[model samples]
Target: MRDRPVPQLPLALILSFLAVSGLLLLEDLFARPFTFLTGISFEAVRRGEMALLLGLAALLAARFVRRDLIHGLLERRAGKALPHLIGDVASLFVLVVGAAIIMTGVYGWDIGAVVAAGGLSLAIVGLALKDVILAVFNGAALNVENAFMVGDRVKIGEVDGTVVQSTWRSTTILTKARRLVTIPNIALGTASITNFDRPDKSEQRVIEICLDYDVTAESAERILLAGVIGAAGISLVDAPRVHAIRLDRDGVVYAIRYVIANHDLGLSSDHAVIKSILAHLRDAGIGVSYPKQEVVTAERRIRVADRTVDRRVLVQQCELFRGLPPDVQARIAEALIEQKVQAGAALIAAGAVRSSLFIVGEGLMKRLRARPDRPGFVEERYVATQAFGRRAFLSDLPHPAPIGAVTQSLVFELTRAAFAGILAAHPEIKVPLATNLARSPTLDITHATEVSALEARAERPVAFYLSLLDAIASSEANAR
Candidate 1:
């Protein structure tokens, strides 16, 4: 980072002294020669020297006042730009006064006449540039009030953006779309302005979502809260909140409010929150409400299929069981046990031995992993036809993550014992199953080793059964 420049009194004094000396030297050299040629006389040269000396002295004095008094006082109390602005205005005032004094005292001009003429000229100029003058005053007011600063996100009338520049004439804003807008200071002063980064850069953002009436308000709130909390760049100090603010014709409206760490992250945070909410709702089998009107005139007929055929269809829909032969697929489908899990139920916990592969038959489930930094969970959504726990079931490893039901769900579980019995009775199926398992992205040999080590230290029956499954899978892989 660049270091701040410090004022040097000795340097200013030396420069001032050299300027005065140069003026005196010019007067001595030109006074006699000019008087002899032009008849203007030596007195005029002396007067010019004095006038120059007065102006130089005023400039030197202004410099000293700014560096020694004004700057020191304002630097700490006001912001970085305000101190410089005050100093510049002060210096200009001193220089203007010094010029007036030089015209009256040195050249012997009438003070009253000068003041009257100057006042009239100023009045005419001010009238011609009234808008400009108002802008200057408005800018000064903004600086004094500390209304907003560069990099602050602000809304002025219809324009909303971060302040890129603030000047006496106009303030420039860089919008979210990357468009630059310049608004006159006077207009900003007259219009209502909202500063999102005032006092603190942290800002609260609200995300409104409409959910069907089928979802209870309490359940919606829980889902919304779970989505926002622990989101990247969101403020954790303030707890995230959800409110069922309105019940409209289409559905109930929910507002999810959360704080972002900085105004700059507002857009990204909003996107993340909305994405999370959608994922959560989808995982919970909840649908957003939309206007729909339907009429039924005839009775509907329902058809029931064979249980084994339904199970086979559900298994085949999953990518994990896609390429298996018909006979093998049928045998696997026969081994699956249909299970129903209620909402908010844990299907699997992290670091626990998982002996079964679960495929979603209906409804939704979510995979959650414990956050290392805090006592919270990060979730991933799973819907119908999705399969989880493939790594643990295939490699005989402990689950490295947890799975839970976000809503009441129907699932089909194929346990290691059930599959092992099939594989033992017909060893030919082991090679193809092992080949599919080996191709799985979740398969990790290291994870299997870690699970084996953990199981060897425990006397759990599940662990012993997992060891037997691991031996069978290893034999199949070796045979290949």
Candidate 2:
């Protein structure tokens, strides 16, 4: 390397120099008599050195400002780092004072009397601010002890809010309604602080549901578990078990032991679990205890498409369908076939023909499939009750997936062909279906590869296509 370039001085340093020069120029103008009386260059040298120190001070202040040191210090203190902050400020003050002393001493001035007087004045000031001094000491002690941090939801006596700031003299709390209250640190440190966010060995949420004592505990438990699992932001980290604590005057009290995700509101999870439970109980002829009494004569059961059931009871059980427009649900009900999947049966096979969509009425199924890119791929899946599949009916293809019974599964099967015919027969249904499948293909076909596999997999084409044919035939029959 031929030569290294020197870095340019900062603008702050240049401004500092200008300020110091102005101070020195002003001193020179005022100290003319002192300069002549001294017979020495004291005035000139003092002016020069004082100018330098003033420039240095300006430079230091500018550096602090640019670095955001003051801002950070204030924020840290506000965020309950007061003791550490106070220590930092004290250290900086001492260093600056020491430097000033050294600079003054070097210029042949006596510092002993000045230091003694300063100490005396500081002691007198501290006595006057006894409460403030005590508060600062308390803050320092609290910082050393570190009783709590910012963002902690705390309660002290009647007060409750998040710890927003802890300063040398006071601790500030921001309440839920965005109100700020300052408590002197001396008082704050002495008070009992209850930190809500503190980690506990066991955490539980209590959900109070008053169901009639006539309802079995088992049913209540099932309902509670469903609600907990369905709610979003709910962590089943703990066994989501419900305990029947007491048969209070109100009803059966259930303490639902549920963990939420890190202090988040789990209203969705709660709602889902509760809804599922209530639906299940209603199906079982159990009712949730609410302050009400009503009596109505049982509606006469009538045979609709060879199945006799109360329409009102059916409506109440399927709350999921309740959200559907009355007309749409009526169409679905009309198209719905009472198809059943027996215990240990093959409902649908992966990579086979598809025809009807099946919605679970009862029981569980295991879904199996290969994991792609794995050596010697294998199938795996576990599905419970309330699962639905529509690809088979829609595509008119071989089951594109396989479902095996874990337990006997009863289901409502909607055959695509049957649904279509039902729509055509019932002009009212035509509008909605037409709207839903507006862009859908008129006909769905199976993959050639799956078609070939179907004959090999089953004894006959008819046997393999029983489900698909059944669906189509039902739809055709409904239309007729």
Candidate 3:
């Protein structure tokens, strides 16, 4: 005989019912009980059968209520408490507990002891993970506070990086060196942190300069203010100012300071402001100072020295003296005479009889246009040059343009006599006097004609006269 396949659930239910019915029938047949007791007329076997049917119905009801409805309710509650992993596990445990309760209560089995044991185990596990739970709490706090977001450059204690990821317990940061560093949330919360990108809407720009020691403090301040104001990318709200500070045995250090809008930082937009300041200083003939070092080959004590050059060679290289002939150049070179003026010396006064031209080779010279009675000089010009002076051989009436030096300058004197001699030799040298020249006479292109009458030439007399008038007008205009 071959074994039959196991019966299905429905078939098993039918078989169980039949077996119980048979047992009840045998119990009724073997032990006959009173059919009438307190006016009841049911057999003992029939009562037993009804009890068994009630038990089966209760089991089915308990399975639905405990395993399905109650389990689902507890699972939903646990799901809310655990967010990432713990919550899911808690939900599963709640579902398993509900199923156990249903099985024990409906089937008359004991499982309450097992439930107590499981609860004890869970308590022990929770105690061992106390630190992990605290970490989770810290992570939650970090997310809630939003102290720093992803891609934010933050410095915590000595660590600085861009926030890459944030979790409940830790954060990942990508450093400038392209390394990822993981840090605990609790540690980050306790450390000192700084964000470089803050204090929006305001920033400062600086231009460093080293001014010569001889420059007056007031003059340096005024020039710095002008330069900073004229520079680009400098905010108008923050006016420029200069700070003069002493250095170690060198000279005065000048800092041109101005503020810019913070949005312009690190964009190289504020560079133009610095560039403009430098250009302004250069245009005003203010030179940037460089370090000077002196070394003596053999000496008990080496003394610092200042070296000087002749101003004659300096003027030869100027653009103003270019294109002149060789002999004229020689005369101009030899005519340069050195003159010394004190610190407040007035070399030339406006409207005065302008005598020999003065060139500044060294030191400073000032030229003024205002009278002595004015509040200040109307025009003050400063000329500081290596070889700067007048060209030799010029008239006094039309004096060469006056220039002032601000330092000890080498000045060249060119008298009217020397200028006249050069002009007499170079007779072809003519100065431009006017824009318009005298008009030249028109050249008459016509000759006396024998057949002058238009009638003989078969031309209209009116047209011929008009053409002659137009030609005459054009010729006269050209001559003019």
Candidate 4:
């Protein structure tokens, strides 16, 4: 369109120009005036057919061959199909050049004045709409460079969003806030762009973990790495990593970095990774460390260590002991010994003779049973304050399955000798203890009196108590 010097040039101008020679040949009045003004020295100017032949040849070349070659060249150079405006410009330039050749070569006219006028007009347009022209060129260049495609998430300057459309003058972006933003191509040309689509769609993120300085770097890394790996939506191909940031007064700070699926899952994916880290921390028996100062206290009979749970608390957790007097409970608590086990370590072995009653104080203890038809073992987890080994401690029965530490854990264990002392001082404890040992451990005995009151509950209570006493006597023999 720019190649046309006249603001209103169209098919009518081309048609009127093609008919000029016919009218010149038909009437001497028109011919004489055209010849004098244009100064045409055409040897065949009097022939209308000659003018038509020249016009047809020019039209054929401009319409088919020249336009195709120009469009093909532009597309190949840009490595993509260019816009419709670019093709239209190319076609119009070809038409204008053909008309110029006809005017100068065929008509014997001087075109210097016409070229000068067209150049001056173009200069005026270049100065007036320079910003718009620059934007158009920038848009073309952006496509050629393959900087980013429509629908790609990108950050240009302060605007971060997905590109909705790219045009000759500007690009439209849809932000996360659901607002539409139109940015000029000139701005994109000057700004730095971060395209999420490049390299891959996955995004890299991080979480921080702090642990007591006493924990080895290797252990911290292993546990933290396991936590990140256990989370879903993580890209294992990238492989998660842990780095030590710095050593604090309270502990060592570690950064856990992992790659997830995409930018859209940002917060939800991070939350999953965090949950995994917490579970692994518990399993590893490592507490997240924080700043704390030790304070000296008065009237202390060796105050319980911050890291250790009170044994009395473990004793009170047991259903049988919870019903007993505090002094009687103290006797059992005094005899209890604190035992620690690391993750995956066996605390109770299958078929091993049970000599102690144990209560979990911290972390998890799990029982593992071999599958009847499968090769692997199934584990059932037991958490804090849950007691185990009542059947083993009250009778001579052996542990049916292996119990291991699922996480770093503490268990308060009351051995046969310690329990024997409590039973000796409190013989009435044996009735319920014998009942538990004689019946299925899974039975929920709300009252330890469930067995002691059997005399009233059962039709033949005498036979039941006698048999219960035998089991109690047998249990006492092991304590001895």
Candidate 5:
């Protein structure tokens, strides 16, 4: 991949050769002309050539020192390599030593005597560049301590971002907003820095929510935990924590904390958790509380549209009934039992056989998986317009998980007996219904191995429904 072959001679050797050649060429071309025009001696030309050689030698020595002392050792260690600041300091030391040798050997100049004479001037310059000196020292300390490295996500005072570059002068940070911030090394050394990507790249984020006073601590915790588990980007290795921090006049405060595998995903993960929590609460018919002013309010009767018309509209929106004819849709709607469920009520118990599908009309519902070993439950939330209990109704299998209400909810319940009667009366819709069910992600035949075994004993229609239910249950298990 390299354009040029590796040099046989060292870089210093090559540099020395070039320096000598250039000096000889310069002397040959200009030495006699300058001696004649300016009446200067040839000896003066030799001295100038010697000084140029000494300067070149010093630079060459510095390069060798830098490569040997820093780059050479660092490259071999890979990720454990030391910072460039140390190499820079080592290179500078080499240059200073080289200069001292040049001064004393070439010109018979005493370096100590020169420094002694310019001590006052040196002090003035040192004072002027105090900040730069301090920064360099701080950078050195930081490198030695191994505080943080490039690519680390850190919060240093008001600036928060991933470190792009770290040097003797400053540390560069690239923020989420795409802004680049350069912080002086001295400032970084003095300030308190929180490194999210250090030790490990995982970070814990807290999602705070306020719920109505009616929600119990146990139910609230269950809902919060379920919401966190359902959210993507959350760390499954660590169980999420929910705390009821305070109770106010308006509501109860909850803090849901979970670990995210990546520090960069903190904000997005929090958003997902919030969305999931809201959905779960809505499914359970739970409402969030907000501060409101009290007034002498009077109850007034409000006019609403016909229940049959509303149910027909809802059935039209449902995926299962969407493709059905208008008359079939009306028949399904008529069979639906409109029920109002209170918060904390169980809609369906785990392992209980059910023959009805429940469609959410308003509010939230949580599906909880019983964990006998843990003494608590794992939950998933469904919101408005969503449907559950399809597998139980279709296959006549026990409910995979218990469904509970988080808030006061309104739902339309459709019994399998009612649906079966409709199917018997109109056999033309059976094929269409089966076709639609076949396409569902939760009803893939490949995942329903258990249902295949049951097919030998049960009738064709019954076996198909059982397989679909098994597939749905398998999918839910895999999701968790």
Candidate 6:
């Protein structure tokens, strides 16, 4: 709103009115004194009064020309408010035309003589202030063409920044390095500008990464897309995407593309997206590939940790399986399958029976449980290494609520028969787990609670373990 016409309008009109009144009242008071002092007739200089009156009227017309003619009428037709310089130019034109009318029309002055004198004066002033005049007109032209506006991120020549101010003389910008830069309007008019801001439109940014030759392009692209799908400051609804751009010297180059809501958050948004990509790659045990030129004296090998290793680690860390034999647990870990869920996709559906258990490998899941009092649902979350579907797998109950992926995630699925097959093959495996469960005060579960006929004494914990496993296995089979 800087240089807008409203503030100066009233002041211009008030000054014009005061000038007209003062000239009329002071004419009689100074006319006799002028005749006595200088011996020049008052009638001769009275035409000067007419000239002054016309000049005051011209100034008033100039203000109206600036506000209503240029700003209100022309700008409305142009779709956006143009640079203030255009209004100034139009107002100056009005003032000059009003002067020409007062001089030639009223006095019948010699047109050729007046033109010669005015032309000489204009040439001298124009030469002295050539750059200033050009800059003003350049600013007007830039606005007429609908160039970048204030707060728009632009790259004018080598400078990349947001336009903080646009004046007739220059455009000032706040750079990414946190410095202010001023680009003269003359230079700006000639320079190529890249405007990153567009009306009602968001921009898509691409992040490029290289991976080693051993890694499949499909898997890398999948992981990269997963990382960006729900990254902070990205447009999730726009559908972030990935592509295998090309084959590089050491590996395949991938481009992950995502939409950004605003251009001003460039640094923070990129930081978040890059951080997420690194995290997913780290969790998957994949190392980022750099330009490889180093010659090895010995053939050095870099090993990527397998998903089987991740499954075993999750199994060993789980409280439910901690007391089981290490070998038996390893076998159960081997039965796990990799599962992937996209952001906002449903992992578990309400009223659906689940026959497999899920352990989060990376990222997050949100459980939407209906609130006791509210009309809508509330959220519960599960992160890396946490598992779900215990009740469904153990007791064959349909899911009470839906579980959705909060971010693109990796999960390990354990089929219903994963534990049951292991127990049937090695029945002795249940002994250690049952003994540990009976000894722990925090784990008060027993077969007696499940079936009143079964005596759940500590001396016979193996019988309880067998019963528990059998019931769980049967429930899972029925659900399947």
Candidate achieving the largest TM-score: 6
Off by over 4 Å in 6: 1-27, 60-82, 110-113, 116-130, 232-237, 290-326, 333-348, 359-367, 378-386, 403-412, 426-470, 473-480
lDDT for model 2: 0.54
- Which runs in model 4 stand beyond 4 Å of their true positions? 1-116, 232-237, 282-480
- Model 6 lDDT per residue over 418-466, tens place: 7667766667766665655445422312111122212222343555645
* Tens-digit lDDT string for candidate 4 (1-480): 112122232465477655764665565656556667788743454543455546665665555433455445544575544444344445566677767767777677678877787898989999999999899888878877878876788999988998877777888889999999999988987999999988778888878877887666655665566566556565544767789999888788999887776767878878888887776566445567866696645342221112244566555555546566677777888887878787668998999997677866555566765544447555455544556775576565798788877555667788866666677668776566544433434322221222332222223233354464455556667656
Flag clash pairs in model 6: none
Candidate 3 lDDT trough over 10 residues, lowest sum: 433-442
Worst 10 residues of 1 by lDDT: 300-309
TM-score of each: 0.58, 0.50, 0.35, 0.47, 0.58, 0.73
Q: Which model is ahead, 5 or 6, in terms of TM-score? A: 6
Candidate 2 stretches greater than 4 Å from native: 1-18, 21-67, 70-124, 142-159, 194-204, 232-238, 264-285, 290-480
Q: Write the per-residue lDDT of candidate 5 for residues 1-480, one digit (tens) a residue.
A: 112223233766567758776766777676778788888788877666676677777776677666654556454555444456777888888778777777787778988899998999989999999999999999988877878876678899999888777778988899989999999988976799888877888887887888777666655765566566656555544777889998877889998878878877777878888887876665444656667565636552221112323677667666666688889988998999987677679888789887788876655577765443446554555545567787677777899787877655567899877776676556566556666665553421121223332232322454474455444444445555
- From the highest lDDT down, the ranking of the candidates is 6, 5, 1, 4, 2, 3
How do the residues 302-398 of candidate 3 rate in per-residue lDDT, one tens digit apiece?
A: 1101112333343443333444565665776576555555444455543445435453333334443323343533333323222222212121343
Indicate which candidate wins on lDDT: 6
For candidate 6, the C-alpha RMSD (Å) to the true structure equals 8.0
**What are the root-mean-square deviations of the candidates from the true structure over C-alphas?**
9.8, 12.2, 23.9, 12.2, 11.5, 8.0
Residue range 1-480, candidate 1, lDDT tens digits: 112367766675568677767767776576677778888868887787788688778878788666656666555455443324456567778888898889888998988887788898999999999999998888878878888876678999999998877767888999989999999988977899899877788878888889877666655765677667524455544667789899888899998887766777778888887887776565455666767575646453221112223677666656667777777778888889977677679888888997788876654577764544457555555555567776677667899887777655667899876776666656665455555544544321112212333233322244443454567655555555
Candidate 6 Cα deviation (angstroms), residue 334? 4.8
- lDDT of all predictions: 0.69, 0.54, 0.48, 0.65, 0.69, 0.70
Q: For each of the candidates, give the backbone clash count.
A: 0, 21, 20, 0, 14, 0
Which of 1 and 3 is ahead in TM-score? Answer: 1
Quick one: how many clashes does candidate 4 have?
A: 0
Clash pairs, model 4 backbone: none
